[model samples]
Target: MTRSLIIAAKCIAFTCLLLAVVGVSLWSASRRVPKFYEHALTQQLPADELAEAADQLEQEVLDLQSEIQSQETWEVIFTSEQINAWLAADLEQKFPQLLPTGVSEPRVAIEDGLAKVACRYTSPKFSTVFSLELDSFLTETTNEFAIRIAKARAGALPVPLKRFFDQITARAEEANLSVLWTQQEDSPVALVKLPTNLDDVRSDVVIEVIEIEEGQIRIAGRVVPGVELQSMPQQPRFADASQPR
Candidate 1:
């Protein structure tokens, strides 16, 4: 009986040791910053250059707004650098409440048809770089856009989709936007229905293209005379500014 007890204790000790090793490995992974995120953080811009970039982004937005109001075809393109600048400086200064609690220092990288968005996430227990890989396209359904979230991670570790889905839903609710959640090839997709009519201007906005290419995103669409398009609020325009520190 003593021999059996000794063997049982030995087995228990081995199990405990194995669990400890696994726990430590996962902890380490959660703390390791991703290469893309690290590079984004290091590429800083001067204050003057940041302001110039922010101005350029605002100009593009204004132009798009004018075209939409005129009921004319319009196309706008934005570079990754210009967007990063605006996010770093103008967004926090002017719209500090835009981001959720415990999230800050947001940045983006556009490459190979993917837009990588990363931000610092802090919690009571830890702080890490949280990122999402996304791609947007017009769906087959009329006036619908699909924003596919390909992957989400915390530092170097993959994060569960539920947390992100909850956050997205909450944000959409706050903005008074309706989001339909679906899955494509195991990835969660958020379907946003674009308003066909601008109530204030009595026009229809049809978005034909949302293409993401290396280092840039291009949006092309047309507006036509119709009922008011003011059923939904217009998307916020991004302006160039400084890099997030």
Candidate 2:
């Protein structure tokens, strides 16, 4: 073969080897990164194990209950799968009204920093689809969780989620859910007031939604100094409400 042809063949071989190495490196990197949601669920405690954990948690809480009557700070964490399962259960029971009249068996999932809700509603005349992506956070004020819509759609049309804020607030009020909500920046947010009822009022407790990460949320609650958690009448409330007055 000509000298030029020989050099060209050598260059081709070198390029092929370089490509193979890069491909292997990419594959290895992908495998090293964890699949957040799937991994979290896979590590979830089984039914019997979860029950034992819950029992242990309850006992611990009861043991410390008396000592915690005074000011104290506490943090609670729940795995994504556990929380999502509870949310699905709660949607079926506690928030039945959340489903439209014709909708049945709605499904809800909390993961990847958003709550995905889906349901089907049908009527004699027509049918519709309801879907929403929601993200929640806490304002500087204690005891308030603010929910914001990331996206919403209904039956071949895009819906302005913020437009539905008042309706949601009204519905929540009518349902006596003990929540106050309004529109902010053309978006709707619901604030769940703590110390829900007059009779349950206790010490100056400040509970807030602190952080929302890929597979979990962190809630931090604290009691102000010099106050008995069980005796305080009203917990401090968030003022902004993330809405226009």
Candidate 3:
């Protein structure tokens, strides 16, 4: 073979090898599961315990609703375990349509003022654990709060911000909640405004505080005289895994 032809052939082979390595690296990274998600999957709770957690969450929601109706000050706290139990045991079985398509097995971890929400995402191309690191706090506006998306990942690989924004927008629309998009320190933040009143309840609900701690979240608010409010959505009971499908 001519020298120039031999050099050209070597260049092509090198390019092919480089592409292969890059492809493999990306595939490996995509399959890497976050430690928090892995732990959530491995830890098994007894049926009775799971039921208790779900019940606690349900009762809290009901209490909050009752307080709103009575125009009283209210505070509700939820633990990570309680929320996870509700998500796993009740959400999918009862309100399957609540979550967008291709998302399942949702779980959350809250610590150091940040909440990590992870879920299993399945697409035709691949399946992976998708997670979002979020920081939520009350903004200056009344009943308004910001959930900043600090980072989003599919497994260990960083995912595009647009993907999460799209999902957030869809969810807000589905729930009839108002969400405004803005930037905070170069990170995307979703500003959520809680309606003062529900269609069925004419009392104004004013949210005053949102506090997050290790493994727990507390929200305190008050209800006063006002016009119409959008009724909050109802929650369904969760079926235990041991139960018949």
**How close to the true structure is residue 151 of candidate 1, measured as C-alpha lDDT?**
85
In order of listing, the candidates' clash counts read: 13, 3, 6
Candidate 2 at residue 27, lDDT?
43
Q: Rank by TM-score, descending?
A: 3, 1, 2
lDDT of model 1 at position 158: 88
Please write out the lDDT profile of model 1 over residues 1-245, one tens digit for every residue. Answer: 99999999999999999999998988888888767777877986888998899889989998888878775788999998899889887998999888889999888999878999999989999898888899998776557787878988887788877655667767787776666777666777777766676555556778889999999999998886544344433542212111111
Off by over 4 Å in 1: 163-167, 227-245
Query: Candidate 3 has what TM-score?
Result: 0.86
Q: Model 3, 1-245: lDDT tens per residue?
A: 69999999999999999999999998888888878778777884688898889889999999878877775788899999999889878998889788778998999988878898999989898998899899988876667787878988987898877655667777887788877677767677777777776665666778888988899999998776643224432221212211111
List where candidate 2 sits over 4 angstroms from the true fold: 1-71, 83-100, 174-186, 196-201, 225-245
lDDT-wise, the better of 1 and 2 is 1
Off by over 4 Å in 3: 163-167, 199-202, 227-245
**Measured by TM-score, how close is model 1 to the native structure?**
0.86
- Find the candidate with the highest TM-score and give its number: 3
